[model samples]
Target: MECKFLLDDFHVFAVDTIGHPGKSAEVCLSPNNYDYGIWVSDIITALGYDKMLCFGGSFGGGILSKTMCVSPEKIEKAVLLVPAGIKNAPAYKLLNMLFPMIMYWITKKETWLLKCILPMAISEKNIASDTYETAKCSIDHVKIKAGMPSDVNPEDMKNYKASTLVMAAEKDCLFPADLVLPQAKKIIADCTVYLITERGHMHYLTEAEKRMIVDFLHDN
Candidate 1:
């Protein structure tokens, strides 16, 4: 979504994660092993970039972390946004979010489901009619797998060589900022962490936040 902001200043490659609803082949690498790292590295090599900045959010963050662990040399810098793999969603939060969506899936109650989940998933300031419609369409059509990515091993993370910027959403149910910050600081050799306030799992970045990210990438 921030591609517009970066387009003039950087060459952005927005890869559709495999198995998500996109043109990419539906071949998911196992998150429990190094397969994800290998898969992403192959893509980068294919794309002909010797090294580049990598930005990932949510599920993409898990894949990026795996890449960082196994092939840090390929990344110039890394930016992770409320990423998975730092920790799994707390069980109660998972159940609360999933139960209604599952019921909607079985019963085909689209309106009811959106109402139930939107407040939990998005901050009030971030809500927009167009974005809401898009998200609804994606959920309705996408064939998604139903599990949080496996957690990253702190031991593996010690091998990471790239400078990293991590932005964690304070209200993020999937990966709480409080939990992710400490673990990231412990593992990543050169890391900067920011806790974004009044944001949920799905966030809207203000101009200041956008500028912060651009500055980070440029500085690194």
Candidate 2:
């Protein structure tokens, strides 16, 4: 698991939460209990980072939100993309809880499981060729070795206090904007929400968004 940021100027340290399938790098402060927010706090103190801005995408949003909740003093500002801590759909939660256990048992049947899991994380129509390939690579790794658990209770989100700029995809199927934005607004009254047109759950750094994010980090 790798948690690196593309920052040419200033220090940007990315923290990975548990059960992130190499996407999030899963580093926690308390290795025994693995409390996500406490781990984030530990990371800040351990790394000697202070009054920093944060940017989180997908499940990284969940971890960042938790990080703010646990250590609100550390975060100066935050930009969240497709944050995944809030559970709007009951059925999705059930499946997410079961995925790791089921994957462990069905080790040989990788393709079938991938088909089931991929659709949950992305819209069927927007599953780009490169995205599908990357997802398959990660899913294949999970099939071979069941990943860690990164699930967070909704209460943790309710406790966050960061002033956040949250963006959601209009056509996102994995983490719907309608559902997540409301939860974010509820969690932090200072949160601002934006719905991007025809985007997916993942927020990649194209030339424009990268510049926007860099400017945001610098200004904040």
Candidate 3:
């Protein structure tokens, strides 16, 4: 069902985020500033949409945080899946990944790539083939992101009133549910959080969970 969401009656619109792949400026916007939110706001206005539902995961969720901070009124509802920008674990926690990543960069070996990703996914079983391949290709090609978006000031989110859904994983090395859920509850006014028990960052959703997300997003 998720596969058919691209051009179905729900009219889901996917935009290539600025500075990522596809048609966007070569410049990477600063996550700490309001630039990302402004860019998103402009896109919404340019498309002549008064309000829209939004979905984002991981790095993209951080960008959505910026949008909520900048243009909360423009969003009808939001689903943040394994989102960032709430409380990202410090970079030191990720030192285990550095060696394998460098080795992969140096050797361009798929084995090394797997090693590079293992820490995030926690186990090979959690790493879907498509997820692995996409990460492999993206890493080989896309320029590395500079940093995660900074924690949004509570005051910045004071005006955000859109109903929001957050799905966070318990063992996410980068944005653990312990960190993300509490803050999400604290900052988002009308928020619902679902913890993916025992799962890490790369865990896949069950079909029922996938259907739940689709249903939520489809509810205009």
The best candidate by TM-score is 3
Q: How would you encode candidate 1's per-residue C-alpha lDDT over 1-220 as one tens digit per residue? A: 3336777678888887776666888777676787887788988999998878999888788888888888888999999888888876666776666766778778878766775566456744565666667667777888756665678888888778789988888888788898988888888999999998977877678888888888999993
Spell out the clash pairs found in candidate 2.
17-26, 19-148, 29-39
User: Which model scores highest in lDDT?
Assistant: 3
Error at 189, model 2, angstroms: 2.8
What lDDT does the true structure give each of the candidates? 0.79, 0.60, 0.83
Instruction: Point out the worst 10-residue segment of candidate 1 by lDDT.
Output: 119-128
Model 1 regions more than 4 Å off: 1-3, 119-125, 128-131
How many clashing residue pairs, candidate 3? 0
Q: How far off is residue 91 in model 1, in Å?
A: 3.2
Residue pairs with colliding backbones in model 1 are none
Candidate 1, residue 115: CA error in Å? 3.7
Rank the models by TM-score, top first.
Answer: 3, 1, 2
Question: How many clashing pairs per prediction, in order?
Answer: 0, 3, 0
| Model 1, TM vs. native | 0.90
lDDT of 3 by residue, 1-220 (tens): 0234424546766778888766877778898877888888888899899888888788788888889999999989998888877778888988877889889999998898898888878899988877887788788898787577777888899899998988899988888999999999999999989898888888878878777777877665
How would you encode candidate 2's per-residue C-alpha lDDT over 1-220 as one tens digit per residue? 1123445755766554555555655443332123666767777778877757777776667666667666778888888776655433344444653565366347746555455545444545545566666666765565433222243444645655657787776645656777777776776757878776666554443566656656666664
